[model samples]
Target chain A: MPNRQITIAELPTDTLEPRHFQLTETDMPKPGEGEVLLRVILMSIDAANRSWMRGATYRDAVKAGDGMPTYAICEVMESNSPRIAKGDIVAAEATWADYTVTKAHKVQKMPKVEPLSHLMSVYGIAGKTAFHGLMSIGNPLPGETVLVSAAAGSVGGYVGQIAKALGCRVVGIAGGAEKCKWVEDELGFDACVDYREGNLSKKLAAACPNGVDIYFDNVGGKILESALNFMNERGRVVCCGAISQYDTDTPTGPRNLPGVVVVKRLRMEGFIVMDFAHDDAKCVRAMQHWVSTGQIKVFEDIVDGLENAPKALIGLLAGDNKGKRLVRVGADPK
Target chain B: MPNRQITIAELPTDTLEPRHFQLTETDMPKPGEGEVLLRVILMSIDAANRSWMRGATYRDAVKAGDGMPTYAICEVMESNSPRIAKGDIVAAEATWADYTVTKAHKVQKMPKVEPLSHLMSVYGIAGKTAFHGLMSIGNPLPGETVLVSAAAGSVGGYVGQIAKALGCRVVGIAGGAEKCKWVEDELGFDACVDYREGNLSKKLAAACPNGVDIYFDNVGGKILESALNFMNERGRVVCCGAISQYDTDTPTGPRNLPGVVVVKRLRMEGFIVMDFAHDDAKCVRAMQHWVSTGQIKVFEDIVDGLENAPKALIGLLAGDNKGKRLVRVGADPK
Candidate 1:
């Protein structure tokens, strides 16, 4: 069978676009020793993917002609290792492709869930990222106010819902009025401010009257600056990602940093979800409980077909998707 | 006795100048109920003094025509409250004046050290600031690389020495070759980089080949940017003070903040010494031990007379002082 793959046509010097990616078809490869050949099911589309194209961050830098890296759920078509069965569903470092061949040890065997998309949403990177960044880094108290940016996006939507589940006053900052409304009404956030509307500092102040005790920052730049203005003394700024900066070459940072950080005695920390991989089992248990009890609502924005992966990422960068965005490459098992 | 006082003639819109202060003779302050009349012995000249004029920080904002506020070692003249006795040596919030009358309860009694300036330098705000910021915030481990800015200055000098005493590799960044030399030869830092020499990032990288484990930030701006680039994975940035930003209206922040902070998984925390006041006793015990064992060295730059207080501050901000800068206003008790 032919494997369709999306490769980087050229590195983006400024804002990322669909033109930066090129779709190519190649012959499917067989599994080598200690390796498994898998059919890519659902590929996670995140802002971090755009960041990887910028330069080396937590992971290796993506270069021109390189297959777009992604966290994907796949079904093993063939396995050379005794550790994995042929039909086993696993999550692994994948590319924007129809199939991938990777070492068996690198792939994580995933448990069967009713909605497979849940593994890409709530039970996967988005869910675990929101949980760890908020619970561990943010350290939100029961009555504390959590001000989260990119509220309508993947990790952010879950972050607000999780903060609400923890009995905190959750306020969200999304791009537009529609997203803001969805974040507040659907996600159960106490308030949602539209960053597209001017005077973010004043709006944030009005929304978070008690002041922000923890700022879960997903989209950095101006939003981070405005949030810093409303942060309470000794507040924690959970530096999750800077989606606002990832797409552009000329990224303006928060000008009030370190000065405001010093005056308010703020603790600004950053982490990758993989940093707490050891606690993934504990996280899944809690998330499962929250999901079953309906305390945490799962929102998945799934785009069909592997060909649309580039467009999905471009749209996601433009703040088009409402929740955890993913590209469904192949059919799910009956 | 006539009290010679230095008042802020006008607040500086940018860099502070000696002409911004006006010295005048005023009537000696008298002790009211629960108040004590203090003879100011030596007044601390800090970069934070200039920051106060910019706007309110941890302390109230210093306005035009207000007496320049200072932390000083004083001799109690008359005490209205039984909590403090006359003739006791104390550290209190005083000003650029020979006498100050403040609530007795606000004063902290001092021990009679051999060199009175030792109390101002090693055992006072400078020492405690270094201790609390590095030990608590930086959380320096032995054999770690600690990079401190303004190394020859008050707090930075102590910070480097304290880190050294804790068995860490300490590199300092100071302005000018003279200050950098003094920082290395006198203060005993592993290496001291001259920030004025341009290409700070390269210099810092060469100095800290193991990469910076903890960055003790004092002068925040370009130096902070340079330090951020050299920070190792999971490094800690101790946001002590932004003296660089304090003196100017158009203060530029580190452009690579939160981004570098995220990629490196760094923890950048800020603090005021008063936040750790409860543990001051414990810190003093540790510091005293370091001082007695010759693990910590004391360096004091005593600028004589109340008239020179303004000049001392201006010079200190301009990177003139090699250690803890102080202005002697009155004679110490015989």
Candidate 2:
């Protein structure tokens, strides 16, 4: 069978638009000694893709003419490992391709959920990033106000739900009314601030009456400045992503950053999910339990076809997606 | 007796010159029920004086007509408290006055070193800030590279020595050849990059062959930008003070900050020494031991008389002081 792959043609100059990628067809290859033939089902679209396109993002950089970097839900079509077999579905780090091969160790066995697409969304890198950042990095205390930027998106959404679970007063910052409403009304966040509104600082201050104790920053710009200004003493800012500044070559720094950090004694740390990859099983187990008990509501914005993967990522970066932006490559063979 | 005091006549309009202060003589007040009358001996000039002059520096802003902000070494002239008595020398939170009063708890018992002047330099706020920031916050590991800005100054100097004692390779950033040489030779730092060199980035890169693991930042601006650029994975940048941006009405933010934190998985925290005030006993004890063992060195650039204090402070802000800047307000009681 022919394998259709989205490969990087060149680096982004003006913007991280879809034109930077070239969708090409290649011949499928046989699995190696311990590798599994993965039939890609669903691929995740993330701001991190922009990082991979430009340079390295905590891992290897995606070079020109290379397969575009991705994390996807896949099925084991063929395998040669003692631990794996055909027909098992899992989440793996594969290319933006229909079918690919990877070592069994690189893939995680997916637990049975209503929609297996979650294995790529909440149960995969996004959920794991939020879990590690909250638990290991932020560690928000009970009744503390947690302000999450991009709160309606994948990682930010999970971060809010988990903070809510931990008895925190969760406040989310989304771009529009629809996303903000979804975050507050559906996701059970205490309040959701529309950053598109002019008075971000005033609105944020009003929302968080006691000042922010934990700021899960995904968007970095004037919004970061607001959060930094509004942070209480010893506040923790978990730097998950900077979707707002990802496209710019020379992004402006937050002018008020250093002084506030000193005065408030704030701990601002940025981390990659793989930093706490050891906590994967534990986080997945807890998330599954939360989802099962109806305490956690998972939202996904799935775009059909692998052809739209680049567009989906571009839209995700631009804050146009409602929930977890994902590209459905093929039907899940369950 | 007449108490001559340096008080701010008005806030800084343009420059922090000596003329901004009005040295007025006032009647000496008697020790109240719980206050001890302090005969000021040594006054410490710091970058934080600039902060106190303009706005709050983890404390209330100094008003226009108020006694100029200061931290001084003093001999108790009279006392109404059980812990303090007349003629006993100590350090207290006093104004830039020949004689002042403070509560007993606010004054610390002076530990006997070779030179009692260290009570205002190595054992005072600068020392404590460096100790707490390096040990409690940065937590530099053995063999790691610690890059300190303003390395010839009090806090940054201490940071380098202590990091060196902890088995870390310490590199420093100073302005001129003289200061850089002093930082490297006298302070025992591995290398001191002269930031005044035309290509600061090239010089810094050459100094720190391995990326910076811990950055003890005092001068924040282009130096901070360079440090942010040179930071290693999981690096910690301790924001102690922003001496470079202190005089500015509008400080330019480090444009490359938030992104580097994410990419490097860096932990950047800014803090005041008062936040770890409880750790005073532990730090003083350790520092005394280090001093006795000759593991730590004390350097002082003492200016004569309280009249030179405003000048000392202005010069300190301008990076004119070679070491710890202090004013010999009066003769040492010992």
Candidate 3:
């Protein structure tokens, strides 16, 4: 099949929108020696992608007129490398297209789990981010209250579950009542606060009376400020992504940041998944065990077609998606 | 010589000034059982004192119509406790008055060293703040570049010296040409930037050819922003104090905080010295060794008279005083 692709036409000019992307068609290129041609099944639209378009991210900025960067689940249709075989499923980072051709080692062969989609959802980017943020940075103590922002979203969902699994009292902040309800009821959070409401502090206070020990922060700005105020002494703010503040040209950061840091003894650190390249297998292995044991729930809000990829990303940034927001590009394997 | 006293007349309401204190006379209280009467020789006027005056600090706030809270080096004039004797010098926290009656348990006996004034400077609060910030929080590598704000001030001066002692390259940021000269010439910093001059970023970049590995931030606002941009990957910002933004009712914090934290993989943590109460002896011992061995320099900008305690504190807050800003309450022991 011919690949349908979306490329960056304009960089985020102070604000990001669907109009910044341009969709185009390209003929499928044959796999070269020591390369694999994969049929992309799903393209993950993540917040970090917005960072790439603006400036240098974990990797180089996705240059203008280039395909949008993404993490994809794919099935190899053709192989020229001895390292990989055709018909093998893999997790790879490639451009946002219906198909991708890359060096064989660029992709990791997907492990066999009950639901193959779980590898792309909970055991994928979101799961790795959550695992690193919660386990490595946060070091949540058992029975300590762990508060997660964007709780119904991909990373936050798994963070709350992992905290709960580690014997923490889990509280979450989501965009709306339905997301909050889904997070609290379905994701096993002790309580979930709807940040859309004005009384976020009051609601959050009510949710975690002991105060927040570990805050898995995905959204920055006001929510971070509120969470900062609600932190326990020596609380950890793991800055996974600042999705809310990314689009602006000049950032108006948290005003109350300094005062709380001294008084609360807070340690706030930011990290990218690429920084843990050596430990990706360890993270994946742990996440796979959690999923296979039914200790974690995986949810995917899959939007169909490469044509809808730009809208999917815009929706994800706007807090419009219910789960791990993805653009499904092809039919599932028989 | 008898004692004189200064008491808080008004709590700081947005702006702090000399009129907030009242000059008064108090009869020197005699030491009761298990107690010591100290002749307050040097009152260390610190930024944390401002925090104490406004509201509760690491300890209770200095109440209006009462002596201000301070850390002081004093001479034990009379002692009822078996552990303390008259004529011994001691370091202690007490209400800021000429004669303070504290339990012998509350005071640490000053170690015998030349220029005993070093006890009130480097072997005191500034020493502890710098040591804890540089050694514990920053954990600066041998060849890493460390940039310090308020480099001529008490804490930043010590931080620069200690970083150099640990084999790290040191750059300092001070307010004026004289202070910059003092920081570079006397403090052994690799370079010093006069922040009063414009093009701070350019000056900083010139100073730090390799990006900053640790930023011992004392002044907040724009200087903090400038330092944030100069950070290397996985750099640590030890949030010791924000003396620049302390006076304001509403804080307008660093703007580039979010982007740099993500891009640089920064870890920013705040710490108060009181948090290391258990390790106080270790800090003092280390500081004493550095001071007695002439490995560290202790500079005190001593302002005379108990009548001027309020002025001394106000000057320290306004960045008027150099080195450890302290008010001499009594004559040095002969």
Candidate 4:
């Protein structure tokens, strides 16, 4: 019966378990009026899934018997909704479940591309968030410099690529030489500094000689502090995520932010991609164009089976994923 | 013959020297090719004049044998430049000297006004700074809420009054009940909160129920912190001066500043009025109009004699000045 739907009955801290989800055998979720039944194909594993449990914005996660928080690409097997017909491939937000019944409008039609897999990578929510952070908040102009942290990660890779496409000199901060090289050579970033080399501040300063015009901060902590010293006057800092402090009991305080904002007259803003979902069509169109033009690239670190989802999430938190971490829940569509 | 102007080597920090300036006759100074000799009639005493001695902005205040950085109503007694002639009354930056020779353009022809003294008060640098901070950076649109700290002081008074004239609901934060009443009743501010009331945050929140849209921050300590919690989304904080932090060895950091920027997406920019000296005429005309129409009021806490300059400056630091603190060097010319 649809491989027995699994759901989280209780929250977990520091570790996750299969008990977080209850496997129940039942009739595959039927598409009610104005709804479509979606079969989960691919689901992304993120470090922020833990934080989603406590955040006010993710109150839906706290609802009893709700599935895990996940973004997945699915195939509409049945539809009573006018917007979607049978066999329509789509992307939707659902939990750790084999099948989900959702509103038709919530399912975005997957775009066609060379690597059909990229529909869930750079053209997906992670990639779109990075794009928006650079374009909307960072507002990088041609000839200006853009610095991105966690450069080898999916979001960081997209940030660097998008900034490069906009004619900005892009610098990336990552953990290792391999990741740094991949970000520079593969992702097309101008330069990548390895934060693992130590002396992060010194290296960052040397890399950004003209000073950073835009900083798309993903791994905020000491890296954000180091980047602040290199920001030029009237710089824009986009705070997309703070992965470095996500698991800590007490969030790290940025000591130098006050002086940075005052002396440089900088603008720093935080945003969530869900807030931009109202214009999903516009985002999808822009991302699709960039993907087709080869101006953007996507990397997927895929793991087989839903049983590996927790492990993939743990690996993501440990910085093991070179790009977007996805757990294949079912067979790929022909 | 005139005094080449000598004064106490340096005024004591704690007390005023009764014999601050001695107008002993030395020799009549000759005007150079681009210089004019001026007979001082009136001079302004500003809070910054105190820090001028320690080389704050105006490099090392007129050494023992030099003139002070005082703006005065003067008569051009002698000139070697074609731009100015003898017996022309002008406004010049002549220090505590009885008569001095300076560059011709440094002496601006005194504008005709009913109370000629008002020109030196309202059309002065402090007024211009207040205007620039309020209109340029603050940009207080009509029906917006504006809050000014140290609202009874020189710059703060203008900030409140100008905000009111711009159709903003203005709130003032001052130390005492008297000053608070003065800012609200006399300056036409919508509300005033006495910070000395112990619960400044509560009082401010109660007064500015709509939330502060623009904040003209003159005192930048606890008041700035309190205002941060009350800022509306997209609030603009004009940092004209941080008087509260100027003297302290270690300035207390505004605890709520980072959250203020993130939550409200606030813009806080620091500025110096000297940056707008090229467009001083526009500000002068605007201020004169506001004064002539009775839409603006000038508050001058006249401390008589140049000798009381030290006390007046100290009073300024202690938030003792009710409005613009001026040293009446000579009789006010009607």
DockQ of each model vs. true complex: 0.78, 0.78, 0.67, 0.17
On the 0 to 100 scale, the lDDT of residue B109 in model 1 is 94
TM-score of 2: 0.96
- Candidate 4 structure quality by residue, lDDT tens digits, A193-230: 99988998888888888999998887766788788878
- The segments of candidate 3 whose C-alpha lies over 4 angstroms from its true place after superposition are A112-114, B1-3, B277-294
lDDT of 3 at B313: 78
**Tens digits of per-residue lDDT for model 3 on A187-231?**
889999999978998998899899989998888888888889888
Model 2, residue B212: distance off in Å is 1.9
Candidate 2's error at B46, in angstroms?
1.2
Q: After TM-score superposition, what is the CA distance of residue A194 in candidate 2 from its true location, in Å? A: 0.9
Candidate 1 clashes: the total is: 0
Provide candidate 1's TM-score on chain A. Answer: 0.98
Candidate 4 C-alpha lDDT tens digits along B1-334:
5454535555434333445444445677778889998876666766555445433232455444444677777778789889988878788878766677899987788765645566666777668888877887888799999999888988888888888888899899998999888888999899999998798888988899999998888777677778877887778877666676544445555644343454355666666676668778888888878888998998777777655565666678888888877776655444
TM-score of each: 0.98, 0.96, 0.96, 0.76
> Model 1, range B1-334, lDDT digits (tens) per residue?
7888999998889888888999999888889999999999999999889888988877789999999889999999999999999899999998889899999999999998867788898888999999999999999999999999989989999999999998999999999998898899988999999989988888888999999999999988888888998999999999998888888888776768768888999999999999999999998999999988988888899999999998999998898888999999888788
Ten-residue region with minimum lDDT total, candidate 4 chain B: B50-59
Looking only at chain B, model 4 earns a TM-score of 0.86
**In lDDT terms, which candidate is top?**
1
In order, the B-chain TM-scores come to: 0.98, 0.95, 0.93, 0.86
Question: In DockQ, how does model 1 score against the reference complex?
Answer: 0.78
Give model 1's TM-score versus the native structure. Answer: 0.98
User: Whole-model lDDT, candidate 4?
Assistant: 0.75
Which tens-of-lDDT digit does each residue in B173-241 have in candidate 2?
988999999888899999998877679899888888998999998988778988899999998999888
